[model samples]
Target: MNHLLIATLLVCLSTTIRAATATPPPVPDVEIVLRETQPLTFPRGSRLPLYLWTPNFPTADDAELERVLKALEARGIALFARWGGNDFAKASAFPLRVARLQKKLGLETSVDATGLAHGFYNGTPATGHVDKDGKRFFDKSFFWSPGCPFAVQPRYDAMRARLEPWLEKYQDEQLRLDFWAADWEFDGPNEWNSGWASARQCVTCRAQIPNLDTDFAAFQTAVRKVRAEMQREVFVKPIQRRFPNARIGNYAMNPHDGRRYWWDFFEKRTDGLPAKAEHGALYRPWAREFEDCGYTVAMPVIYTWFNLHGEYPFANHQYRWFYNLLLEASSTGRHTTPAVPRVTFVHWTTTNPPKELPKDFEALTETSYEELLWHLLLRGHDTFAMWCPAPELAQEVRPVHRVYAAALEYKEFLDHGQPVLFDVPKQPGFVVSALQLGKKLLIRRTDFGPAPAFFELKLANGTTLRVPKVDGKCLLLTTP
Candidate 1:
């Protein structure tokens, strides 16, 4: 046989063999129950997708839950069942059922389990801290006293026991071990204050580090050591061994607060005393651990409060800084990989009642929400999660729907295009977010105050695309 003919025959044979072995993707029941609707469209790029963070109400009637799932499906959103606190075994069932229901409804869902970094006293009595007088210190925060020893072994065993059965049960689902490292500090000299003082009182902890309190440097060192131990013993090792295939991640606080706190600490300002210690150092090691164990890691960019209060106008800058810091640290040999840093733009207070809202809280305007979404996208973050406590609130609040619609639109635009080089113009008062996908380039211009008459985009091919005003705002432009 001729060489070319033989090669073609071999290719055909390989293709046939692959086809014979290939397994079909699961067909969801919802697809059959409800006819597929037309995909949403955006003027530029594609629709942005949203993940709904619903409270994990275990006792909610199945029918009501299904209705909620169906409503979310209609809106083109996925569900994120939020379950916090201890009692993992009991709480695990809620998310498991939610996941099952979502799968049954043909909607997407993640298995979210909370892993408290510092032990909770009420949930696990043994984890509480005793004062010098032998009285247990109890605080509203639920964090054990600083000098108390974290029941690392007990917590780890409990977590493993609780999660193993679920992992085996839902072998196909992704498990997010949302680390509620509540009140852990990431900056300054006071970084270890969360539990250090009380931790020192624990006999076991004191035996290990007798000088933890007396020596500030020793306390910091001990805190780092304990953090690493907790990351390994409490989370990474057990999860990797038991649920090897699960998509695991920890909950990270909004990076802006961390940055500002650290900035203030380093500047010796008393106002924003460091909340956590050495933000980068605290997260970098954990990021590496997640990457090494083949798990997903997320850092949330919480711009809602700032946007609401209007304290920070240029919040995106801080977000960009935080992301870049992590990116740089997580980068290896000029490429960033499975350290797949997911930046979740979180707006948790949307569910707060009007009376409960902060004094500085201003209802997030649709324009502001859209602008923030675009700003984060421009900074190279696509994954987003919004905490909407109740589904009905989306209807009650017009801007919530508007914000979600923009996200869906952005996701659609992204799906249709490949990201290319884009730069922020040096000129003041305006910023341009541009991406060239295929033959067309989608550009969105955002102005600080008044809308500019028009902005000119100088493309690589020496083409000038003039983006004029659309509905009194600088909307997206598609240029070849």
Candidate 2:
């Protein structure tokens, strides 16, 4: 009897070990329709910049749509469309038009879907209670409002129902979720101080925190926890399960004021409740979470174009901020997943300067456009997507076209080469990147300052090469 019992225990232990060591099932095979497209190649380790054009699909007529599509394709640009708005059902038909146009033009017609983070309301009765002011809270702007309580089961179920059908229809394409959380900071206007603040007083939300009504800390903690939970469980996990093979990209906002509310809540750490953490410390973990969960791309859309003029004219201080954040995040040994490349989406136009530019600064010049792109490329960003480019603004479009031509001129070197290698003891006002293609070595240096500057490059063989100032900020050199 004793021998039999020992043998049974050993057998059970062997079975448990096998289960633990077994590999997970492979992710479903997803059909990539536009794998050959230029913009689609960036996610697959290509160094080329992915350019996307954002245009309203439902309202665009067939002729106008074709014109825009052809124009963008001529420049190797891809279309990024929003999937879940009030007119989403109607917008579903837009993809068919895009596909047909691509076929007609002999172009790859795959449109990437943009899932607006807070735009998932199905127009049904609430399974949750009303806010303190007896108002229904829904997202009014791109950012999250405290009034919108998305923690209720009914809301999650409704959102899943609405999203699943759309995902099923386009299971083969990539989906990018934008503005994934609230943007609350001291710098911005305090819009949440009114009824929006009391909107979190829903029954389900209140049940999560005992002292939510009286304790401000408790209310903040509860709201953060609910938002993170909804983001992960409702927004992220279900989509992953439904479309196991689709490429999921998240546009996580790197909150400007250094408050990592989502990261703190997700980790259940309340010690630094009200204090601001370093930007890298906050965004790195948030990005890692999505990366580990099979997200192909994660980009922090820095929403501070208005504040750019306050610091330096057309300087793109935000790009430098994001670059430093990426440097800090990578230095820590915690991010074990695949390295996610950086992308910048800048709001640059002539007619509408968000705020007044400095006295000596011009609005939008060819130099400003060129400098921004060069800085992003030198600082380690893989792609740059402009928010909106109005063709009507001929002055602005002309400069943009010039820069686009320059990018295309260097596509062969930029697309096929390895990551940019920077020089040690980096120059103060200049940034340099070197790439070797076969026997030829190409070095590109960009000057960030207003004044033209000269530089020198010393090779390992103790040979020094002098670089001259060009007409523009960027200069590309090839060695024999």
Candidate 3:
């Protein structure tokens, strides 16, 4: 009897082993790994600076739209056009028109998904709310609240789940949740009207996460577990199940903290990272989250906010000082994307200006547009997505679009080649700096003092040349 029992036990153990090693359920059929090994460096391939905007730009008639599209086609600029979703129109009226433009020009299109605001899938409508602190407020007339039942994370999951069919249905190369940025920061001007204070008090949030009588720390722990599940069930899982190969990313709206609590809550919900991380510590959670989840994250900074003059100009200075730091933080553990304010955006120049510039600034004597683009590029960003204002506004802005187009064309040249040299000198004293990438060179001129001084670019092949009459005091020399 003992021998028989031993033999039976061995057989059972073998069966268990075989079951454990039986291919692990086919690994979910998702290709999380890529053939390319190293982290994807920016400029993987060049993409022109993009302009993101609603088709409802003031005075944006059909003819104007066609003209602007033609201009973008000629300049090879990508247009991140927001399909009209507001009361002005129900569905995008320009899809066919834009499609023809893209096909004719070989351009790419990503829909401006405003579903979060439109309450398309399952996002919470922007119900006016009161904060825990007893402040009442509401997002602007068009914006919607992102607060939803934790159980509805599956709704978010389904939101993207619906994207796969849309992609195949539309034959799209990429999709951008353009305006559906899940921003929860309430620092602008609202008084917190809804009174739905604290995630702990959230009815759906509480149901999704039990243990309310637990300590704050313990509750936080529970929230973390649920948050992970939410992310998986909501964003990542459904995305993998549906598209499997779709390039997905969340668009961040708030620029850098400044009364913003979205990142803070997001960090806590994800991994308890502090919002005020000393010198970029706050970004690790999102970075780690995106990396682990296998997706891209886009954080858009208010680069246009750096030029506010007067007492506000000092604020702009503060913004400038923190710009690079913010980029570093946002890119931490994640890929970085830099987007500039489109020259076409009229308010961009008037709203954001160096204390020295006028309200309706026509030209900038201190900094050139190319210098701005180069600076954005140097900060380790992959794509350039900007907001495009109207054509009349573009014309009034001293033709900055012309400068933008030129820089974009040059960007294509620089992306594949190595930069051999670069230099930038601020105005006044002609502060000059030069840098070399591979076979290309960049030279910059700035206002330091008051001296008309210049630098010469000499190549290893004994070639010499002077700077051109460029909008921004910048120069680029590339090899074939």
Candidate 4:
């Protein structure tokens, strides 16, 4: 055989053997190139602002509040804080009667998560309600407000009296907020925290659903409508009755597609997940509740809770985990024309931290954490709303400020630009997503592993990106 032919035959044989093996080893020095497509577009005159919801700073002293507000203003935070007293006052901004530090610092303030759940949705002992049989409505869980359907209507009238003070206070235009979210999650007529069947075994609920004994589906359907009714009457009507233009929504209101992720991977067991019997089946079916309530903004959540991150196979990395949540938000949250503004509540801190993990687990470092924010913006989310713990404030806010600076640096692209490359490449190690407006293409790429990476990124418009090696950090670049 000729030397060239003999050499080619040996190379082909080696390649064939490698391909024939099961679960072939990862290729070294892999090159990944992704094309841009399916950008979340914005209509003319509408722009997504760079916003952050900071925990309330000291408002007791004029000088101290101004100093803190000025410091955050310098860091490019345009939004922060909620309002009210008791627990809600902890998040209150501009609460000082003599001081309005936000005006001085040019930071915007908003209200968040009013304690509706705290006030009315606790167990019957706490909520002070009884079933038609003169027994406490409490069941296996404290979130048992689904009983006595007739009792809920009468409770709403009483709620109006208590809610009046807050609404009256915000009537001051200077104190008014354009956004509001309710603290009604995990406390309504839902099956997650506890089943409503026990509570609904009453005169009123059974009267409405005469055959609830034989059919649980009727109870489930009726309770969802009851929850929707609660949202409209309890949260929306009361708040919107005061501020007609306000964008109103609540936490966990966005349809979650009936799946909850909690500590389990492709090759792991489900022993660590929260028990179904204790927490009930984690399911929130789409009920068109937001649409019925006329929600202006979709309040979907993309959290970095370590335990909640492990249920799916693709969630091997924090970056991948957050991206999946974002995918969930954008897919279900924006399934309409003139997409509802997704002012998503995102957190990078380890909420519900798992007790143990795979030995090779990668907690979100500085680069990976910041990448979460950038991906949210590039994935069509309108704002980055967060609450940093006071102790971890300095470290966590590093990513927030850095991402905010990029928002200012590329304001045009962020303001008017639609995000391209929303679909990520399926391969591991290399991840790329982008945004484009007209001729401007702003792409964000982060490769896994320690070594610096350089790769070619091809675009559908016949443009190719050749950038310097990104040393295991997020790379945000624009191409004209």
RMSD of each: 17.9, 22.6, 24.4, 18.1
Better of 1 and 4 by TM-score: 4
List the candidate 2 regions with Cα displacement exceeding 4 Å: 1-52, 57-68, 85-89, 103-144, 147-154, 171-246, 250-294, 302-304, 312-343, 350-364, 389-397, 416-428, 433-442, 448-480
lDDT of each: 0.44, 0.43, 0.38, 0.54
Candidate 3 local distance difference test against the native: 0.38
Q: Write one digit per residue (lDDT tens) for candidate 2, span 1-480.
A: 698998999999999999899996632111011221223222222342344434334346788777666655555455455454556568667665655565677655333444434533433335223556655554333232333344354466665665566656554443332212221121111112332234344655566557655565555544445444555565567666655433345444222222222221112223322343433222212212333334444444422233233333234443332233233322221222225444444445532344556565444344545654554444344554544544433333334435544555556555554433444221225555554454344455655454346566665555565666554544556542
Model 3 misplaced stretches (Cα beyond 4 Å)? 1-46, 52-71, 81-93, 116-149, 157-165, 172-197, 200-250, 253-299, 306-347, 350-370, 388-392, 395-400, 408-413, 417-436, 439-472, 475-480
Please write out the lDDT profile of model 3 over residues 415-469, one tens digit for every residue. 5433333232211233333344666655544443344444455667787656443
lDDT of 2: 0.43
Question: Model 1 — TM-score against the truth?
Answer: 0.57
Model 4 CA deviation exceeding 4 Å by range: 1-54, 78-82, 85-107, 122-136, 142-150, 172-174, 196-203, 206-221, 255-284, 312-323, 336-339, 354-360, 420-430, 448-480
Cα displacement (angstroms), candidate 4, residue 146, comes to 5.6
Q: Is candidate 1 or candidate 3 better by TM-score?
A: 1
Error of 1 at 126 (Å): 8.1
Candidate 1: stretches off by over 4 Å: 1-49, 55-68, 81-97, 104-106, 115-154, 172-225, 228-245, 253-299, 306-345, 348-364, 388-392, 395-401, 406-413, 416-428, 438-440, 450-480
* Top of the candidates by TM-score: 4
